[model samples]
Target: FFWGFLAGFLEIVPYVGTTIGGILPVFYMLMVSDTLWQPLAVIGLYILVQQIEGNIISPNIMGPSIKINPMFIILGLFVGGIVWGISGMILALPILAVSKEIFRSFDATEPLSYLMENGLARKKDVFLERFDHEKHRILRLFFEKREEGE
Candidate 1:
Protein backbone atom coordinates (compact mmCIF):
# COMPACT_ATOMS: atom_id res chain seq x y z
CA PHE A 1 0.00 0.00 0.00
CA PHE A 2 2.68 2.48 0.99
CA TRP A 3 4.85 1.36 -1.90
CA GLY A 4 2.00 1.91 -4.35
CA PHE A 5 1.41 5.37 -2.93
CA LEU A 6 5.10 6.18 -3.14
CA ALA A 7 5.30 4.96 -6.74
CA GLY A 8 2.23 6.96 -7.76
CA PHE A 9 3.47 10.13 -6.05
CA LEU A 10 6.99 9.89 -7.40
CA GLU A 11 5.77 9.14 -10.95
CA ILE A 12 5.24 12.87 -11.33
CA VAL A 13 9.01 13.54 -11.27
CA PRO A 14 9.83 11.45 -14.38
CA TYR A 15 12.83 9.17 -15.22
CA VAL A 16 14.36 8.18 -11.87
CA GLY A 17 11.19 8.60 -9.79
CA THR A 18 9.74 5.15 -10.46
CA THR A 19 13.16 3.63 -9.82
CA ILE A 20 13.56 5.23 -6.39
CA GLY A 21 9.97 4.38 -5.55
CA GLY A 22 10.51 0.70 -6.35
CA ILE A 23 13.88 0.55 -4.58
CA LEU A 24 12.66 1.75 -1.19
CA PRO A 25 10.08 -1.01 -0.87
CA VAL A 26 12.65 -3.61 -1.89
CA PHE A 27 14.99 -2.27 0.78
CA TYR A 28 12.23 -2.52 3.39
CA MET A 29 11.51 -6.10 2.30
CA LEU A 30 15.18 -7.01 2.58
CA MET A 31 15.35 -5.73 6.14
CA VAL A 32 12.15 -7.44 7.35
CA SER A 33 11.85 -10.62 5.26
CA ASP A 34 13.40 -13.80 6.62
CA THR A 35 13.61 -15.32 3.12
CA LEU A 36 15.63 -13.75 0.32
CA TRP A 37 13.26 -14.89 -2.42
CA GLN A 38 10.63 -12.27 -1.52
CA PRO A 39 12.98 -9.36 -2.01
CA LEU A 40 14.34 -10.89 -5.21
CA ALA A 41 10.80 -11.35 -6.49
CA VAL A 42 9.98 -7.74 -5.69
CA ILE A 43 13.08 -6.63 -7.62
CA GLY A 44 12.06 -8.73 -10.62
CA LEU A 45 8.52 -7.36 -10.59
CA TYR A 46 9.76 -3.78 -10.52
CA ILE A 47 12.15 -4.43 -13.42
CA LEU A 48 9.37 -5.95 -15.52
CA VAL A 49 7.03 -3.06 -14.79
CA GLN A 50 9.74 -0.49 -15.50
CA GLN A 51 10.60 -2.15 -18.81
CA ILE A 52 6.97 -2.21 -19.92
CA GLU A 53 6.33 1.36 -18.93
CA GLY A 54 9.57 2.78 -20.35
CA ASN A 55 9.86 0.79 -23.57
CA ILE A 56 6.25 0.12 -24.57
CA ILE A 57 4.00 2.71 -22.93
CA SER A 58 6.22 5.78 -22.94
CA PRO A 59 7.61 5.52 -26.48
CA ASN A 60 4.21 4.92 -28.09
CA ILE A 61 1.97 7.12 -25.90
CA MET A 62 3.99 9.83 -24.15
CA GLY A 63 6.53 10.25 -26.95
CA PRO A 64 4.21 11.74 -29.56
CA SER A 65 2.26 13.77 -27.00
CA ILE A 66 5.27 15.40 -25.37
CA LYS A 67 7.33 15.76 -28.60
CA ILE A 68 10.33 17.05 -26.66
CA ASN A 69 13.61 15.17 -26.67
CA PRO A 70 14.54 13.11 -23.61
CA MET A 71 17.76 15.08 -23.36
CA PHE A 72 15.86 18.36 -22.92
CA ILE A 73 13.50 16.77 -20.42
CA ILE A 74 16.45 15.52 -18.38
CA LEU A 75 18.07 18.96 -18.60
CA GLY A 76 14.87 20.64 -17.51
CA LEU A 77 14.51 18.21 -14.63
CA PHE A 78 17.98 19.07 -13.40
CA VAL A 79 17.52 22.82 -13.81
CA GLY A 80 14.11 22.72 -12.17
CA GLY A 81 15.30 20.63 -9.24
CA ILE A 82 18.27 22.94 -8.77
CA VAL A 83 16.04 25.99 -8.89
CA TRP A 84 13.03 24.84 -6.80
CA GLY A 85 13.57 21.30 -5.51
CA ILE A 86 10.75 18.71 -5.84
CA SER A 87 8.08 21.19 -6.82
CA GLY A 88 10.29 22.37 -9.66
CA MET A 89 10.79 18.82 -10.91
CA ILE A 90 7.04 18.26 -10.90
CA LEU A 91 6.48 21.46 -12.90
CA ALA A 92 9.41 21.12 -15.29
CA LEU A 93 7.74 19.19 -18.12
CA PRO A 94 4.77 21.54 -18.44
CA ILE A 95 7.05 24.56 -18.24
CA LEU A 96 9.32 23.14 -20.93
CA ALA A 97 6.40 22.30 -23.21
CA VAL A 98 5.01 25.79 -22.88
CA SER A 99 8.40 27.33 -23.50
CA LYS A 100 8.91 25.16 -26.59
CA GLU A 101 5.58 26.31 -28.00
CA ILE A 102 6.37 29.92 -27.25
CA PHE A 103 9.65 29.58 -29.05
CA ARG A 104 7.95 27.87 -31.98
CA SER A 105 5.43 30.67 -32.40
CA PHE A 106 8.01 33.33 -33.14
CA ASP A 107 10.34 33.39 -36.15
CA ALA A 108 13.26 34.66 -34.05
CA THR A 109 13.02 31.80 -31.58
CA GLU A 110 12.14 28.96 -33.94
CA PRO A 111 15.67 27.63 -33.73
CA LEU A 112 15.16 27.04 -30.02
CA SER A 113 12.02 25.09 -30.77
CA TYR A 114 14.01 22.94 -33.17
CA LEU A 115 16.62 22.39 -30.50
CA MET A 116 14.01 21.27 -27.98
CA GLU A 117 12.32 18.93 -30.43
CA ASN A 118 13.06 15.21 -30.76
CA GLY A 119 15.71 14.97 -33.45
CA LEU A 120 14.64 11.75 -35.09
CA ALA A 121 14.02 13.47 -38.44
CA ARG A 122 16.51 16.29 -38.24
CA LYS A 123 19.16 16.11 -40.98
CA LYS A 124 21.79 18.55 -39.79
CA ASP A 125 23.12 20.28 -36.69
CA VAL A 126 23.31 24.01 -37.45
CA PHE A 127 25.09 25.03 -34.28
CA LEU A 128 27.46 22.09 -34.35
CA GLU A 129 28.46 22.86 -37.93
CA ARG A 130 29.43 26.43 -37.02
CA PHE A 131 31.27 25.25 -33.91
CA ASP A 132 33.16 22.66 -35.91
CA HIS A 133 34.19 25.26 -38.51
CA GLU A 134 35.63 27.48 -35.77
CA LYS A 135 37.31 24.52 -34.12
CA HIS A 136 39.07 23.55 -37.35
CA ARG A 137 40.23 27.10 -37.89
CA ILE A 138 41.69 27.26 -34.38
CA LEU A 139 43.39 23.90 -34.80
CA ARG A 140 44.87 24.97 -38.13
CA LEU A 141 46.32 28.14 -36.58
CA PHE A 142 47.73 26.19 -33.62
CA PHE A 143 49.40 23.65 -35.88
CA GLU A 144 50.80 26.42 -38.10
CA LYS A 145 52.39 28.11 -35.06
CA ARG A 146 53.81 24.76 -33.86
CA GLU A 147 55.33 24.13 -37.32
CA GLU A 148 56.92 27.64 -37.25
CA GLY A 149 58.49 26.98 -33.79
CA GLU A 150 56.22 29.54 -32.06
Candidate 2:
Protein backbone atom coordinates (compact mmCIF):
# COMPACT_ATOMS: atom_id res chain seq x y z
CA PHE A 1 0.00 0.00 0.00
CA PHE A 2 2.81 2.38 0.92
CA TRP A 3 4.62 1.61 -2.30
CA GLY A 4 1.50 2.15 -4.36
CA PHE A 5 0.82 5.38 -2.53
CA LEU A 6 4.34 6.65 -3.12
CA ALA A 7 4.11 5.63 -6.76
CA GLY A 8 0.99 7.81 -6.96
CA PHE A 9 2.90 10.73 -5.48
CA LEU A 10 5.92 10.33 -7.77
CA GLU A 11 3.57 10.35 -10.73
CA ILE A 12 3.57 14.10 -10.29
CA VAL A 13 7.13 14.30 -11.65
CA PRO A 14 7.33 14.74 -15.42
CA TYR A 15 9.46 12.18 -17.30
CA VAL A 16 11.01 9.91 -14.72
CA GLY A 17 7.39 9.67 -13.60
CA THR A 18 6.59 6.47 -11.71
CA THR A 19 9.73 4.42 -12.48
CA ILE A 20 11.95 5.63 -9.69
CA GLY A 21 8.98 5.69 -7.36
CA GLY A 22 8.16 2.06 -8.14
CA ILE A 23 11.73 0.93 -7.54
CA LEU A 24 11.89 2.46 -4.08
CA PRO A 25 9.42 0.09 -2.46
CA VAL A 26 11.14 -3.02 -3.77
CA PHE A 27 14.52 -1.74 -2.65
CA TYR A 28 13.11 -1.03 0.80
CA MET A 29 11.71 -4.51 1.04
CA LEU A 30 15.04 -6.02 -0.01
CA MET A 31 16.76 -4.11 2.72
CA VAL A 32 14.19 -4.46 5.51
CA SER A 33 12.33 -7.71 5.14
CA ASP A 34 13.22 -10.44 7.64
CA THR A 35 11.92 -13.45 5.70
CA LEU A 36 13.15 -14.46 2.27
CA TRP A 37 9.65 -15.32 1.11
CA GLN A 38 8.21 -12.02 2.31
CA PRO A 39 10.83 -9.98 0.43
CA LEU A 40 10.18 -12.03 -2.69
CA ALA A 41 6.45 -11.40 -2.30
CA VAL A 42 7.05 -7.71 -1.89
CA ILE A 43 9.27 -7.70 -4.94
CA GLY A 44 6.63 -9.57 -6.88
CA LEU A 45 4.01 -7.03 -5.90
CA TYR A 46 6.26 -4.20 -7.09
CA ILE A 47 6.75 -5.96 -10.43
CA LEU A 48 3.01 -6.39 -10.79
CA VAL A 49 2.29 -2.79 -9.96
CA GLN A 50 5.01 -1.72 -12.37
CA GLN A 51 3.44 -3.68 -15.21
CA ILE A 52 0.01 -2.19 -14.51
CA GLU A 53 1.44 1.30 -14.28
CA GLY A 54 3.46 0.88 -17.46
CA ASN A 55 0.56 -0.43 -19.49
CA ILE A 56 -2.59 1.19 -18.16
CA ILE A 57 -1.98 4.02 -15.70
CA SER A 58 1.05 5.64 -17.35
CA PRO A 59 -0.49 5.69 -20.80
CA ASN A 60 -3.64 7.38 -19.49
CA ILE A 61 -2.03 9.74 -16.97
CA MET A 62 1.44 10.83 -18.11
CA GLY A 63 1.02 10.20 -21.83
CA PRO A 64 2.34 12.94 -24.10
CA SER A 65 3.28 15.11 -21.15
CA ILE A 66 6.48 13.08 -21.02
CA LYS A 67 6.39 11.92 -24.59
CA ILE A 68 10.07 12.56 -25.27
CA ASN A 69 11.87 9.78 -27.14
CA PRO A 70 13.52 7.02 -25.17
CA MET A 71 16.94 7.91 -26.62
CA PHE A 72 16.80 11.43 -25.19
CA ILE A 73 15.78 10.05 -21.83
CA ILE A 74 18.76 7.70 -21.87
CA LEU A 75 21.07 10.56 -22.83
CA GLY A 76 19.74 12.74 -20.03
CA LEU A 77 20.05 9.92 -17.55
CA PHE A 78 23.60 9.16 -18.68
CA VAL A 79 24.73 12.77 -18.35
CA GLY A 80 22.87 13.24 -15.09
CA GLY A 81 24.21 10.01 -13.69
CA ILE A 82 27.75 11.06 -14.59
CA VAL A 83 27.43 14.50 -13.05
CA TRP A 84 25.18 14.04 -10.03
CA GLY A 85 24.92 10.29 -9.69
CA ILE A 86 21.49 8.86 -8.83
CA SER A 87 19.97 12.14 -7.68
CA GLY A 88 21.17 13.81 -10.87
CA MET A 89 19.67 11.02 -12.94
CA ILE A 90 16.41 11.38 -11.06
CA LEU A 91 16.26 15.14 -11.64
CA ALA A 92 17.48 15.06 -15.26
CA LEU A 93 14.08 14.58 -16.89
CA PRO A 94 12.50 17.72 -15.44
CA ILE A 95 15.60 19.72 -16.25
CA LEU A 96 15.56 18.50 -19.84
CA ALA A 97 11.82 19.25 -20.12
CA VAL A 98 12.31 22.81 -18.93
CA SER A 99 15.23 23.30 -21.30
CA LYS A 100 13.22 21.98 -24.26
CA GLU A 101 10.37 24.35 -23.45
CA ILE A 102 12.82 27.22 -23.33
CA PHE A 103 14.24 26.21 -26.70
CA ARG A 104 10.80 26.00 -28.30
CA SER A 105 9.87 29.43 -27.00
CA PHE A 106 13.07 30.86 -28.43
CA ASP A 107 12.44 29.46 -31.93
CA ALA A 108 10.44 32.44 -33.17
CA THR A 109 10.78 33.67 -36.81
CA GLU A 110 12.76 36.88 -36.89
CA PRO A 111 16.30 38.22 -36.57
CA LEU A 112 15.61 38.83 -32.90
CA SER A 113 13.99 35.43 -32.75
CA TYR A 114 17.13 33.90 -34.24
CA LEU A 115 19.13 35.58 -31.56
CA MET A 116 16.74 34.38 -28.90
CA GLU A 117 16.70 30.72 -29.91
CA ASN A 118 19.19 29.27 -27.46
CA GLY A 119 20.29 26.32 -29.57
CA LEU A 120 22.72 24.71 -32.00
CA ALA A 121 21.13 26.60 -34.93
CA ARG A 122 22.60 29.86 -33.76
CA LYS A 123 25.93 28.22 -33.11
CA LYS A 124 25.92 26.56 -36.50
CA ASP A 125 25.13 29.87 -38.18
CA VAL A 126 28.02 31.50 -36.42
CA PHE A 127 30.38 28.74 -37.46
CA LEU A 128 29.24 28.88 -41.05
CA GLU A 129 29.58 32.63 -41.15
CA ARG A 130 33.09 32.40 -39.81
CA PHE A 131 33.98 29.77 -42.38
CA ASP A 132 32.69 32.01 -45.19
CA HIS A 133 34.75 34.88 -43.90
CA GLU A 134 37.87 32.69 -43.91
CA LYS A 135 37.12 31.50 -47.44
CA HIS A 136 36.78 35.11 -48.62
CA ARG A 137 40.14 35.87 -47.02
CA ILE A 138 41.76 32.96 -48.87
CA LEU A 139 40.26 34.12 -52.18
CA ARG A 140 41.56 37.62 -51.59
CA LEU A 141 45.02 36.16 -51.00
CA PHE A 142 44.82 34.25 -54.30
CA PHE A 143 43.79 37.41 -56.20
CA GLU A 144 46.63 39.38 -54.59
CA LYS A 145 49.15 36.70 -55.68
CA ARG A 146 47.83 36.85 -59.26
CA GLU A 147 48.05 40.65 -59.34
CA GLU A 148 51.61 40.60 -57.98
CA GLY A 149 52.68 38.07 -60.63
CA GLU A 150 51.08 40.16 -63.41
Worst-scoring 10-residue span by lDDT in model 1:
130-139
Clashes of each: 0, 0
TM-scores of all predicted structures: 0.54, 0.45
The lDDT leader among the candidates is: 1
lDDT of 2 by residue, 8-110 (tens): 8888884576668766776787788877787678767767877886799877786467654556667889999999998899898888777666644532212
Per-residue lDDT tens digits of candidate 1, residues 58-86? 78987898899899999999999999998
Q: Highest TM-score among the candidates is held by which one?
A: 1
Every candidate's lDDT: 0.81, 0.65
Q: Show where candidate 2 strays beyond 4 Å.
A: 1-42, 54-56, 108-150
TM-score of 1: 0.54
Each prediction's Cα RMSD? 10.8, 11.0
